[model samples]
Target chain A: MTKEHIVSAFDRDLEGIQATVMKMGGLVEEALRGAIKALETGDTELAQKVRKSDRSVDELDLKVKHDAARILALRSPTASDLRLVLSVIEISAHLERCGDYAKNIAKRSIVLAENAQIEGTVPALRRMATFVLSMLSDALDAYIRKDASLAEAVIERDLEADDMYNTLFRSLLTHMMEDPRSIAAGMHLHFIAKNIERVGDHATGIAEQTIYVVTGALPEDDRPKKDGTSITFKPSDE
Target chain B: MTKEHIVSAFDRDLEGIQATVMKMGGLVEEALRGAIKALETGDTELAQKVRKSDRSVDELDLKVKHDAARILALRSPTASDLRLVLSVIEISAHLERCGDYAKNIAKRSIVLAENAQIEGTVPALRRMATFVLSMLSDALDAYIRKDASLAEAVIERDLEADDMYNTLFRSLLTHMMEDPRSIAAGMHLHFIAKNIERVGDHATGIAEQTIYVVTGALPEDDRPKKDGTSITFKPSDE
Candidate 1:
């Protein structure tokens, strides 16, 4: 191959790898939405479908890794090119993790569906899932467009999800406190809530990668993570 | 600069990055042990210490990425050499995640100590924490030596930690059910337990990277993941 042909071929390889990552990202967003919808509606079959489809997500993860590795070795792209290759690898992994969290949510849906529905819990969780899915989709768009502001915007919204989780966790606690019957369902719902919270985290992670890729700098570390605060409480003397 | 000098410089760069990864791994192990000790003894001071030290972990993560990217750009390593660099990048990220989990466990310890301790729970968690730390240390050792069998051994031990988590979850549930008083503490302990469980997962992730680096193949997928199984229970009618 001529020198010109080789350069064009490298560009094509990078583009192809990125396109695969986008496809994987789209699938992951769908899985998150589908999982939450299934849980909200007690659609066990849709939950099962979400769980089963993760195989393709896993396969895409491997492909992204493999192709990125090949590009790194063969093309020896530098600067922004190198950053894009590395970001593709990192972003692909984050997308895969989102896929896993979605699968976790879907798996928990089966159990939640069988048990008594915890009041107000499903709707809160459904909202959190939708919010994070939007963040993820936006993060993917920011990555594709190399829009750092959009990526930072996604990061800024993470604390909102955390606040929602803390509220939901306490409400579930009060529900269980009022009625002993809700404990089993409460525990499952709590985990599902936690799973959705993690989906937000992974979305933020994708945005972080995007910021790093665009500016070649670390994302801001200003957000004070108020994570374990939700678990703190006044010791009720029984 | 001669090609030979450039090649030797790449070798030195790889060595430096690997050494940094080892340092990060050691710190992560210490953080895990310290976090668990803090929980075991209700030492809020030590918990704060573990959380404070994670900044260094994050810095090392960035440093590893920087050095690895430089090697990829400047040297263009081949075959096993490329795999080793990629593995170092992945393993460093896994170690950073392990550090994050340790920090999370420590953060939750403050709440657990302030509130009433669920009877017999801290000791169980301490044991699980110790078990996972040993696995992490062993996994790191295996990575340094490229010992596939030892790495696979670490992977095999993950289910042990999972079983421990399942048993502890049930016990915590039983405790909460028997007395409304234990609910707050039980919930905090449950999250701490889950964080420790995730530490095990990250350690296994490092081991999987070790296996990949040594064998140039995916780790065996024979072990069935029994996760999300702990949430399944027959709800007792109140």
Candidate 2:
């Protein structure tokens, strides 16, 4: 093949790989939204759908890795192209993790659906899930556009998700404290909340990879973390 | 430079990256051991030490990624060498996550140290941590030796860790249900248990990478997972 033809072929390979990543990201976003919707509406079937969708997400992740590896081996593209390939692999990994968290949420939602609804918990969780969903969607958009600024914005919003989680965690604790009878349901809701919080984390991870792809370096400072539930606890005696 | 010299330099680069990964893994193992030890002994200072050690692990992870990217760009390694580089990147990422989980355990240890020790909790956690620590150590060993069988063994052991986690989960829930006053502490302990379980997951991840590096293909069957907490919840009234 002519030199130009070979270069174009490599570009095509990268484009194909990236396209698959975007498709995978889309599936993850759908899973997150569907899982939360199922939790909010008590739709076990929808939750099952979200859980089943994860298989496609996992398969796409594998495909992206395989195709990226093939490109790196055959094309030997250097500089920006090399960064793109590496970033694609990392991004795909993050998306796969997000899919897993979404699946976890869906699984818990199915269980929560069977139990009596924990009063006022689903609304707060829904809001957090909505915000996280936007962050993930924006992060994926930034990846396609190579917009570092947009990715930075997504990173900044993770703190908000953490803050929401903190509030939900405290409220859930109080709920269980007030009525020890709700402890089982409370634990399930707490895990679902934690799962949503983790989905936000993976979204921030994707945004970081986007910044690395565009700027060739990760953000210098660690993103703000407001998860204080690990350290803060009200003694029952108090 | 002679082509032979170039190849030798690439070999050195691969060796250096692998060595750094092993060092990072060693730090993670130390952090895990120290965190669990702190929890078991109620040593806040040891917990602090484990938390501080994570920065070094993170730095080593970045170094491995940077060095691997450089090798990819400069050496243009193909086939097995290329796979080795990719595997190093993945292995380093897994070890970095393990470091994070250990740090999380340490953070929780500090908190738990300040609070009253829940009876009979520390021993169970310690046993689980020890098993997980061995899995991580063995996974790293498999990586350095390219021992697929050993890696497969580590992967198999993850199911056992999940089973241990399930047992711990039920026991903790029972503890909390009996005394609502212990809810906060129970939640923290549950998270610590989850964190250790996640460490095992990452170890399995590293082992999977080892299998890929050795055999040029990932195992077709999914590793077994027995984490039933999300799906199984006994009603509080029961």
On DockQ, the candidate that comes out on top is: 2
Q: Highest lDDT, which number?
A: 2
- For model 2, the stretches where C-alpha displacement exceeds 4 angstroms are A1-7, A234-238, B1-7, B234-238
Q: What's model 2's lDDT at A104? A: 84
iRMSD for each candidate structure, in the order shown: 2.3, 2.2
State the DockQ, from 0 to 1, for candidate 1: 0.45
- State the weakest 10-residue window (summed lDDT) of model 2 chain B: B229-238
TM-score of each: 0.93, 0.94
How do the residues A6-32 of candidate 1 rate in per-residue lDDT, one tens digit apiece?
A: 557888998899999999998998898
TM-score of 1: 0.93
Provide DockQ values for all models, in the order shown. 0.45, 0.56
lDDT of 2 at B4: 56
Q: What interface root-mean-square deviation (Å) does model 1 yield?
A: 2.3
